[model samples]
Target: MMSITFSGWEAVKDRKNLSANEEPKKGHCYMMYHGTHLQNAKTIISRGFQPSKDGLLGPGVYVSRNIEKAKCYPLTVDKKDKVVFKLQVRVGKVKKINCDNHPMQKTWHQNGFDCAWVPPNSSISSIRSGREEDCVWDPSRISIVDVACCVDPATRKELRRLIQHNNRSGGECDLCHEESDCNPHPVQSCWQCGKTICAFQQKHHCKH
Candidate 1:
């Protein structure tokens, strides 16, 4: 597991002071978090944001204005075991796509454009469908400042307890119902299914 030391958590939180205003400043620095499956947390931290089809604004990174609001996102609330990440983004240049005249009105009606996803693709004209008209921002101008796992003291304790329980109980594999062993046959819970299964059996149990 990634180290969840106090210094690490404090280091990430300290970045918030880079900006003076509560809202995104002239530098376009914003603090956001993506709530997702525990299995995907490491991938997201490494590769940066990937647009998802299930996302409200179609395929794009969705972020809340604040950490508290981010904690309320669907994945976090639905899957109590899901991981939430504190993300730092520095937008070099951004276009306001949330107003009344925005081209992607059909999907943007949700006002998701308020925190829109800027595609990495080069030209607005290159984007197919009516979405091409909405692809007004240049993604290359954006930079991912940092990504960190959000683990509060309470959450850390809960995670530790869960791991300890899994190690001690050697819970039944949700896949084959075989008794799981912690030392050699470690048990891991499926972030989506909420089932405890042998870590090696995850491939057979999870389609995701």
Candidate 2:
């Protein structure tokens, strides 16, 4: 069994008590954020080491509804430091997992967390970056909630606040009401115009 963990600002791939850099035998996992973060600080914040292309790397982006696309970053293997990239696309089936009502976990150090791809039920204590499928991105792809659907109260509170701000309340059928503040109808939200509508205004999905 091998172990994988984040320490000193890098995802360290360790095996049998020896660091990947010092180990005699190389483990299967690779160092993902070789230079993405600053290793000098004992106190660090994880922007979630993405390959740098996933489009969410911008500074001060926290609006949940604003994460429109998956950014891409290059993946490098240990053996040769070969430069190749893996496009972490959104899993269409689960891309909209709606963390809207869920509370944010303490595990997340930043607003929009990074994708730490680890296998299901497999401890990072001794793990490897086996394949692209072995890991996954959150919210836009596959959310971290897959391991457990239940979330903490604080995170749920934060998510609810974001959804409301986005006008995606998923609330009452206001279109059917006498006074419709919701032009698009029910359960509709516009990232561009930043408004929510109802079923009657599905067209708003396009027009801001």
Candidate 3:
């Protein structure tokens, strides 16, 4: 594992000059977290993230600067199955939509803004969690840097599956072993071997 030099969480917390109605400065990069089920995390780690079709903030990837807020996601997945992804995001242009039916709640992206932000507890009707959140319009602007596993002491079955995967795919899983015909379009190309393998087989092909 590589050494981490900066604390993203703390950096965001340190911005004390902004008022409640203000949004974070745009055209800057920050560290953020996205929480999801383990199964979904695996797919994202391999195939890359896809923007949501629709949400409170419209078509974008929802993330939080607060790790605690991120941890309470899906509201359905078990704690042991939850995984939080650490990402580096470039919020190109920002818009603040703090209240319900704020006019720009769902159309911020359609505007010139690249990100929409909701301040904590701004709207009881909209932000039920009373937590700060951000919706990034461009998925390409966000990059997953690391994943924090919530599960510990993996089950015997899970451990066996992981071992088998590592052996077959060289520490890669998910996309690497999927059937070639599953997607008609090319998923991605292998980086290590420079082979044009199916996105589902990139890891497997790279090792071979």
Best by TM-score: 3
Residues 1-208 of candidate 2: C-alpha lDDT, one tens digit per residue: 3432211121232223322223112112222211111121111111222322232222211211101111111223232221111111222111111122223222222434442222222333222432111222332331111101112445434433443333333323554332222122234344455455443432333442
Is 1 or 2 the stronger prediction by TM-score?
1
Question: Which digits, one per residue and each the tens of the lDDT, describe model 1 over residues 24-131?
Answer: 443355544555665565444344456545432344455543444345444324544466555445433333333333475335425433334333232334233212
Error of model 1, residue 38, in angstroms: 1.4
TM-score of candidate 2 relative to the true fold: 0.18
lDDT, candidate 3, 1-208, per-residue tens:
3422211111112323344344677766677888887767656655657898999888899998878888988677788888777776778889988888889989987889999998887873856768889999888777665564456545424533543453345333344453221123234444555544443332242344
TM-score against native, each model: 0.39, 0.18, 0.62
* lDDT by candidate, in order shown: 0.41, 0.25, 0.66
Tell me model 1's lDDT, rounded to 2 decimals: 0.41
Clashing pairs in 3: 175-200, 176-200
Which runs of model 3 end up more than 4 angstroms from their true locations?
A: 1-22, 153-208
